[model samples]
Target: MKKVVSLLALVMLLNGCDDGNLTQEDINFEDIPTQSCSINNIIYKLKDEESLLLEIPETSFTNEPSTVGEPTLLDINSANRVVYRFYNGTVSATNICETIPPATPIVTDQWSAIAGKIQIFTTAVKTTNATDNSTKITGYNHNIVFKNITFAKNNGTQVYETFPFGDYVTTANALPFLFDQTVEQCSASKQIYNYNSSEALLLDIDPSLIVNSATPLNTPRTGLIGTTVNKLTYRLFSGLLTSGYFCTGTIPSTPTVSEEWVATSGVSNVSGIIEVTTTTLGTGFKHVIVLKNVTMKKGTNDFKLGDSFIYGELLTTN
Candidate 1:
């Protein structure tokens, strides 16, 4: 009777070890780089024959950086789903992209994320100008993480305290600034402007800066960019601007401003200084506008105008 009992216990242990469905396999692809499908919403990571996919909403990865202490939180549901797939053969992006899938790699085991919180922490990737000590946002990085997540398998479930999905990077839009050295001043609004069809660079001048008198060769008139006083603004419009667009009594509504960047305020001679060098033209006074160490900011990102940036010449007939 003792021998029979020992034999039965040994057989049960052997049976449990042979059963493949009884235990969960370790699923980790943290070292691999994250990849994306042609579809904007799908992001995945692949390691050998296993793939971890995330079907998230486009809004979750915004172009703008997240607030100081706040991150974008999303719930795992039908719309924002996470899936883990195991394949018989090695897998590549061709297996999951929207384009025609391959025939060989077949999915053998699958796990679906049931309940979880997706957290996206966004920050700007910046490059600094060595000459001006100014920074420009070249791209944004979205770090995706899962918190209190449960992934359900066929027979059991796996829970993770925190799963890092890795970073997704997006490039920033290039500024459309194509000025051809010609500058125009608004007679009614007292605003100097240089514009293409879709974008405009405007400066709200302090009236005293554009006087008809000639400024000394080396000593140019300088003023700091400010809010209500000597302000500089750059705007991108939705539609092409009409001629004399800024001189109107009431700003037009058709070609609305799509984006705007303002010059950063600074001390008198340090940063964001507007230098105006006036010389005597044929009867009129020619004022050459140059921006010195000026930084243009929109939200958390900023770009410098360099140590000495010539902003075109303005002619005033006295």
Candidate 2:
């Protein structure tokens, strides 16, 4: 009776090893870097004789950060698929990426993800300047994860509670900001601006900053960038910024402001200091505005304008 039971146990163990088409039980490509095809939607990771492929919309990975507790969810379906393929021999990116796959590395086993949700948790990746400790957003990292995924093969299906798909990064949009050194002041409001076509640097100056009095040659009049008084702003517009845009009594609704960054509130002479050197220019006074160690900030990201930055010159006829 003991010999018969031992033979039955050995048979059960051998049957368990034949798990349908799943010879490689562990589908681990965690350390491998994800590669994308020319089609853009297809992303895959290749290991020796195995490959894991994902076909999802490129828009799935948004450049913006995902909200905490609420990750971006995408359902696994016909259009969005996850596939694991085992080949007869070693495979390269050409096997999966090319329109016509090579015939040599033929697929031996295949598992298709039948049901699940692809969860993406995204965060902004920033680069900080060593000189001033200012930060700029370089890219965004999208962390991919699979939840309650079920993979179906020829014989049966295998369910996974959770699976990590690793991180995919996308570069941030570049800020095209270039100035021509020419400054214009608003006749209706206490504002001065230096602008290109779509980018503008504006300063809502204090009344005392641009007085007609001539300042000393070396010692210029200094002030702080405050919330209400000496406010400094950098604006990126969607449309062309005409000369009449700021001169209007009310801020125009057209040529909408896409992005805005404000100067960090000053700490006396340390940062955000507005220095104006007033020199007599014919009948009027030329007030050359220079920003000293100014740091511009938008949310958690910030960048400095170096040690000294010229904010252009403003003229007063008083």
Best by TM-score: 1
lDDT of 2 by residue, 231-294 (tens): 9999889999887777677878979998888999999768889999999999998989998888
lDDT of 1 by residue, 76-112 (tens): 9999999989999999898998566888699999989
Candidate 1, which ten residues in sequence have the lowest lDDT sum? 17-26
What is the lDDT of every predicted structure here? 0.84, 0.84
Candidate 2: count of backbone clashes, pairs at least 3 residues apart or interchain? 0
Give residue 283's lDDT in candidate 2 (0 to 100): 94
On a 0 to 100 scale, what is the lDDT of residue 311 in model 1?
90
Cα lDDT for residue 55, candidate 2: 95
lDDT for model 2, on a 0 to 1 scale?
0.84
- TM, every model: 0.87, 0.78
